[model samples]
Target chain A: MTSAASSPIEFYFDFSSPYGYLAARIIDAEAAELGRKVTWRPFLLGAVMKQTKAEPLLTIPIKGDYARHDLARAARYYDIPFVVPPQFPFASIAACRAFYWLNGTDPAKARDFALFLYERAFLAGKDISKPDSVLEAASDAGLDAAAMALALQDPAIKELLKAEVDKAIKKGVFGSPFFLVDGEPFWGHDRIAEVREWLRKGGW
Target chain B: MTSAASSPIEFYFDFSSPYGYLAARIIDAEAAELGRKVTWRPFLLGAVMKQTKAEPLLTIPIKGDYARHDLARAARYYDIPFVVPPQFPFASIAACRAFYWLNGTDPAKARDFALFLYERAFLAGKDISKPDSVLEAASDAGLDAAAMALALQDPAIKELLKAEVDKAIKKGVFGSPFFLVDGEPFWGHDRIAEVREWLRKGGW
Candidate 1:
């Protein structure tokens, strides 16, 4: 619980979930207020899903219904816009690879892309599976659409994402937006505020 | 969502936790009023721990602190007696096996034993790992202490307990007092009310 030499908070997220998007948006402000650094560790949620042999959020009958309820309540609580995606379970592989490439060039730009994609998927019901939709999100993030398209095709980006996903799974992370502060796992978006409170108290 | 085919909400619990004791004392009353049968399924919390590689409740630094705060608040909220146990991480294996054996003969007695053990372990600060303490709890449940002692020697009880643990893991159970009504797993004693509400809605 020492205050000195605190490790940066790592946020693991994906573009497919609106909750991840919402968490990513608020995490930086929350960490900054607590005098902590946030490391936006972008990993493929799809990869983690495949590795864990867990059903997708939308597939779990009770949780799926709860997710809808959660979004409505969360949006009202946070004063954010939320619209249900018509064609959910959007293919996030391309968008995730783009994030891997963005991790090298500009982390802020990558975060912006994530936020933009999240807004489109959950706010406007945009079809994120379409390459055009992904390209548009990159453009909104202030990245060159052509450059992002090229980076999305790069084998290195795929490899990096695969490695990150493997590492997360090995660390016993079974869900998204898992915030690791000083080696302690604070799981789920619901735990974000609590993690900040812990950081403020200089507790790991 | 059919009311006619409503199955009794099955609650799987271990007697080691104060939360389980609280739930055991009140759950039957809640279910009975709703015209739903409450099935008590006792399994070794230790066995579930081994399968999931979960640490003891006292070992989880953050959760340990939270439990102390949460349990007291819960006790007061539910108006239940809850004194923290002096020797936690007590072996719930024997208690679990006793329930497994009694499920064949008398589930009502098994439920009573579970409630008695929770009260003794948490309220009385008793070391439930001791053979005499367990025998006393079983005796309090209106069972013959001699027969309960002999049943503890049966290898079949151990196998039955292990199978329950195995079945729990297979069903994606990761915590104690898991309620499965119509195949939906609602975890923790805190979730008992939610289970009742879900059952009332006649949906799994």
Candidate 2:
């Protein structure tokens, strides 16, 4: 774990993971405390699952049940307000594409976009799978909503998002929020501490 | 999932997962109640992680913290004894290989062996990783202890164990205890209800 406060930390995420939402709630705050910059990478979870040929989180019986309960418990533990959205697993494709756009143009704006979507879906209980919700989110981030809307339809951006999903698959990521501080992959939201420690030690 | 009582239901397992132990306790009884047979497959969770690139239960933050409390709650819910074994995940290579021996020879005996190991290690506080303890377990199951001890050393049996682990990786299995009937995978011990329902429907 590196103690260098200015180090960069990458967070690969999707809206499908409740723990991702939980992690997002405090990750920015935690990183700020450690004086680290977080790089948000929005990737399609469904595409990643397909490439990895892994079952969705909902398929894991014991873990799935515990996830719902634990998510509520975690929100309380962290003193954050939470609500389960009706259309969960809101189509993450658009959000992922927006992230793809941000990856090239304005990366920090991408981080804000991720947090906006997370808070909307997990805390504010908004349906984020729709394009309009994403547009509203883009507007909230001070980005041109209409321009971002048009960019979402671009096949190249879709392929770009798909390529990142493919990259994550090659790296052996089956789920999110998958975190890699240096070279080591710390999977799931619960692994942030280890990731923080790794960063604290300069990812040795 | 199939309701054909004569046909066995697949039992997917990993040695490191304590919930697998808890599920092993009642799966056979539940299957018997439904007049179905169980086919036990011993798979390596670590190998699955290597294949799918998912983290272990302990490595995942939220899942890890909740697992301790959840396991205790599950024990109470099932009215079963649970001791959280001293060296958890007391390497199941020996136990898994032994299952290979008993699987073909006597599947019922294999089920008994799994239960004994789970009860001893997780409930009675026994170190099942030891050779002597395994021999005792074999003897308790009415198997010849000396012959079983010798059989445990067979390279062919070790290969069989390896094959099961390899097969699990291909099957998109990430954890235990996964239950598959036909092509559908019902992961975790708590998933038995869905497995039972699917069995009632004849197949999934």
Best by TM-score: 1
TM-score of each: 0.58, 0.54
How much does candidate 1 score in TM-score? 0.58
Native-structure RMSD, model 1: 8.5
For A2-68, candidate 1 gives per-residue lDDT tens digits of 5545567888776777778778768888888777777777666666655444457765643455466
Worst lDDT run of 10 residues, candidate 2 chain A, spans A58-67
- Candidate 1 ranges beyond 4 A from true positions: A1-6, B1-115, B118-136, B140-204
The deviation in Å at residue A182 for candidate 2 is 38
lDDT of 2 by residue, A48-111 (tens): 5554444566445444554575566557657788887887656788888887887688787777
| Candidate 2 local distance difference test against the native | 0.73
Evaluated with lDDT, which candidate comes out highest?
2
Interface RMSD of every candidate? Answer: 9.8, 13.6
Docking class of 2: incorrect
lDDT of 2 by residue, B171-192 (tens): 6566788876665666666667
Give TM-score, chain B, model 1.
Answer: 0.89
Q: Assess the local accuracy of residue A124 in candidate 1 as a C-alpha lDDT between 0 and 100.
A: 80
- lDDT (0-100) at residue A99 of candidate 2? 77
